[model samples]
Target: MTREVRLTPVNEQNLEPLLSVAVAEAEPDEVMPPVDAPAGWSQARRDAFREFHRSHFGGLAGPTGNLMYAIEQDGDVVGMIRLGRTDEPGTLETGMWLGKSTRGQGIGLIALRLVLAEAIAAGARRVVADTRPENLPAVNLLRRSGAVLAQDGTTVRAEIRLGVSEDVDLLDAG
Candidate 1:
């Protein structure tokens, strides 16, 4: 049986578990990649990383356009997916990471399908995601989800058109 993984807005109580997942998902060499750094980031880059974690996972309780959702399985948080920068209205970028304990369980594919469905239902015409060139698992996952390779450079951009309803079923078929 498949459990429905819903995207719920994050708040104080859930911050710790979210941070724990983030830390657990990252290896020493993969904490934050250079691509994650914004332009002109100096020491502030590290500070910004800390601030991002604090703001997003510190449980301060504030208004944020960024919608963070926890992936729940068997009533436990196993991973997270974020749908961000939706100001464009019809297009959204997604980022996701799953806990090590939950890896290789085919949960990421299910979570991706759920997020794509939610994005389309929320009026997103296209959804995009980027991953490092060396992240083979993510690359394969995106391709398996029917995301076309748009740009393949230092970072790879994968996009799926949500304007057509068939794309949703294609992603969910597996």
Candidate 2:
């Protein structure tokens, strides 16, 4: 089945649905690092989620700049991708999250390729991603995406050089 994965801008119309994914998480909601809430979430949760995303979408840019995109599959939102430039020239850093139900379905790989395509088009020489070292799924995702992995104490960094090319299968192989 074709996922028809594409990157779209996040706006008010789609923000709630994205948050709903977090709220739907069966865990107790918190405004902290893994911010989450419930269906009938309080204003506090909304504010926190908005604040965190605001930075990614509109607030002060990180490092050089930042770009956020909504990950859509067959016209439905499935995840998010954020790209922020690092201090180094021609390099950009990216992070992404997919709805629990969307994991392991090859959507993440598609999103990674899309993000890389955008970054390279914007003149990025390399793309880097940092995830927790213990997050095996994330680590494996990056590795399978052909990124070089380096683990520091707290963060595992994966990098892809955009100026180079390898025969990668965009939809089937990661």
Candidate 3:
């Protein structure tokens, strides 16, 4: 049986596994995904990614700009989930990436649920996501999680309404 999947707030200390997953899955398998490699695999490229993540992860872009979480199983990192604010107020978008080995097994669905919960707590009334039309895993996850799909061009965008409220209990509230 598979173990229960859990989420840890992403931080500098436990982010290595997340970066590793991106590199390990950069190459497409028998099935191609719309997303590409995390960027280049060179050392310079890796350095750039590290620097960029540090900024975004550090919240330098503001609280709502990039909120990320680490997907964990048995205390080990397996993937990452991120919720980001769009240009529109009170709206957010989500994205996720899992290790090739960790795909399926209901991990993605759970991660998305957790992230969307956090989004709701953060005052997002709506969240949207998009993937290639053939990315059935994502399409299905969104549907199963109650996101409405809007297909256009070669991609489909999933939108979930979290409901607007003036008294949302923000997750970061101290």
Instruction: Please name the candidate that would achieve the greatest TM-score relative to the true structure.
Output: 3
Q: Tens digit of lDDT per residue, candidate 3, span 1-174? A: 867778777788876776776667644232122333453475655555565556567441465477677788777788777777677666788888788887888889888888877787677788899888898888999999999999999989999988668456343243
Q: Tens digits of per-residue lDDT for model 2 on 1-174? A: 766999975667778777776566422232224545544466766677766665656511443266777788998877788777676666778888887788889888899999998877666778899888887888988998889999888999899888633343222221
Model 1 clash pairs are none
lDDT of 3 at 174: 30
Residue 23 local lDDT, model 1: 59
On lDDT, who's better, 1 or 2? Answer: 2
Candidates' C-alpha lDDT: 0.66, 0.72, 0.73
By TM-score, the better pick of 2 and 3 is 3
Per-model TM-score, in order, reads: 0.70, 0.79, 0.80
lDDT string for model 1 (30-97, tens) is 43335455454345454554455445542212354455677877767777777655444457788888
Off by over 4 Å in 2: 26-42, 58-64, 164-174
lDDT for model 2, on a 0 to 1 scale? 0.72
TM-score of 1: 0.70
**Per-candidate RMSD vs. true structure?**
7.5, 6.9, 4.5
